[model samples]
Target: MHVTAADGWRLPAGPVRRWTLRPAAVGEPVVLSVNQRNHLAGVVAGQPSVWLAADLPAGSVPGIEAPTDLLDGLLARHAALRTAVAPGDGTGAVLHAPDGLVWVEDDVVRAGTSSDATSAVRDLLDRACHPLAPGPPVAAALVGAGAAARFVLAGDHLVLDAWSVALLASELGTPRALPAAPAFPALAARWAAEPALPPDDARLHAWLAFLDGLDQALPTFPLDLGTAPGERFPQRTLVVPFLDAATVAALDDLGRPEGASAYAAVLLALGRAVRAQRDEPAATALPLLVPVGTRRTEEERATVGWCTTTVPLVVAATDDLRATGERLRAALALGSVPLDQVLGSLPRPLRRTRADVFMVSWIDYRRLPTVPAGTNHVSNVTEADDVQLWLSRTDAGVAVRARIPDHPPAVAVVTALLERWVAEVALLLR
Candidate 1:
């Protein structure tokens, strides 16, 4: 395979060399993700590229090869999956950084039952999904054996985000070239070199000042779901789906009066649910953190990283749901705030407090490729949970993903909470 840079820049063409990061210390609580506003979006800073290793039971699935050809196709199809910087992309080299490419690493492990296979897969995913690490960006990985054989892909957030995970799943097992997408290095150079990017505005400056006062990085914030210690990582997810087209139209109509969006309504509902789960005063304002995609330009959409900002809605217990929804609307209106600056403004202590940061994030990815005609896709499992909530938009309508800190009571939990939240929000709007 060969690559010719569109802009006439010559790139290295050679066989790949690999290295391993030996464990230096024990009990290192990996920073799996950063606050929405932080530069590291759900990844650790400085380490460009994350390694996603999937442990599969030793067996042969139809149409799959041991050293998969699909893997090669994926890398060749997406340049971001193959290239890496020699020194890394950070500070000065940020402009030339690639979206970090993707590579597959393989290892074999002892056989286990279906349950073990599933658990092992989840464990590797959680362990490898570190908060956005800085670079030399390379979304490649080294795979190896553990409880089972694993395949890992390490890449930087500078080129991708969480939603891309679904895409990874889609590409895996069945690698094929996608229509040409934007290149990461080009976008990075443009962003870094552009003179017109608005300087830190007044609001941005004030927020930064606030963050300067509190730089105390504290213990990792645990999502308290009130589960037995062992149950902390419940192999359950709340699955939710969107409302019908008619219902979605109704929501758009209702939103016209106060400029509320289907997203705002979802936030209001999630805030209410979180309040109901806790003993806090109803009047206490619960801030719902909504993630706004900053990939606004045609070219920007294709590039990734922590390009999302948090829009906070302070929901009052006494406020009617509509009123809360309006507040969300107003907050979303002022969506130009830079997320990095916002995180920088938070007193380091408060910023790291999981308890203080309980909120909701809105994700919309309907415009990208759709799930293939007959693929099995799952939705949110429940309507409510204890703490953090996620509302995502799809061509169908709105969906949800809520994270509860053991305070709320429920049974038979699963992974489609966001889907259900989207359904009801559309219902209320309509």
Candidate 2:
């Protein structure tokens, strides 16, 4: 949220320098998370990476000759960078990486203007930060110098989750003030060793029942997205204003009596919008892929790594708002078990058949650490078959962001869907 590079900051006029890093000593290889393995399963050569970019305020890095000075400390602080996933046929071990900016002068290119430099740095990240490959899973670059410096930190989902990306963005904007926590490689090893439940376990049985209910297919868009089977289209995003703070409070208040939350209310509204349009009068539940935060303790909260797992939430619709909310409350406990374990317990073919997953994730920044205003998340051009919805509640209010395949029909239909969702939510207030 600091003044941008354009506001009185200077872009480096000299030849822009570069630094590449390797691990000083190797750590033990760890198994990739199920999310990581699946995300890497899609990577191909020349794939534009999924990434995050930020603009650090003026004088954020005083006495620093280059952004590398800041990058070096960041590299040390977050160990997820040091674990590189070897690209093969979908499955591989995360090999230990050589330590920080130890290598100098990989190459330097000269750019005359800020725009040119920005493009060059972006390309650099796209090359270095590829996922499911035999190279660094993380890379960072900076444009401009001194007060006007901005950075682009790119990595695959394997090593960097949304929470990790947000924390990294905040750190780049401010100096490295947080204390060091446990390294990710060690934590990952311990996590990999955790015992999985047998097939007869109650949690496994509940998940199995849900999966059996899903049959073999995942939830598709209620309306056509104008794409062919397995066809990939460039991603597009739309951010639409949702409920205001007062409305959110009212919804929560209404649900509180039923031991339900505003989240459950919104889920019910989402289900109604989706099913009502599809004209499935008998449909009573909607299953959403939910990203559950896996950070086990407060100390691990600030540590930068992929501390999240994806689980399914079957949002059931009922006559009483109380019943729907209570159902959601009980379902959240299922996330405490790791998703890989759930998938591992299932038949292998079932996992391979599902693609272009339909997921809806909700994150409330108001509950976590404070972030500077104007600090936004950035992503890259990629192909997708389904629309992914992220509902984020900030101090400004609740807003739902949708990433859909960029097409005229999609824009039109999705606009209608969100509008309906808003209207459905408004009914709960009445």
Return the top candidate by lDDT: 2
lDDT string, candidate 2, 1-430, tens digits: 2211111223444355554444444455577666666566656433344644443432443434566667766776777766676445555655553352253434666778866775666566556666644455566554555545545555656677667766776676665466665676666677778888776887677777777777745555656777777777767777767888888888889999888888889888887777666667577677767777878888787777777776667776554678777667666667767667776666643642324677787788776555445555555546666878878877666888787877888878788889988888888778
Clashes of 2: 6
- RMSD over all Cα atoms, model 2: 4.4
- Model 1 spans > 4 angstroms off: 1-73, 76-113, 119-159, 166-180, 185-237, 240-249, 272-284, 304-306, 316-326, 333-335, 343-351, 373-386, 395-398, 406-430
Return the TM-score for each candidate structure. Answer: 0.56, 0.84
Task: Indicate the residue-level lDDT of 267 in model 2.
Answer: 85
lDDT per residue (tens digit) for residues 146-187 in model 1 = 323333333344335444433544455344445545544444
Number of the top TM-score candidate: 2
The segments of candidate 2 whose C-alpha lies over 4 angstroms from its true place after superposition are 1-28, 44-49, 53-65, 86-118, 132-134, 144-149, 173-177, 351-354
- Candidate 1, residue 228: the lDDT equals 49
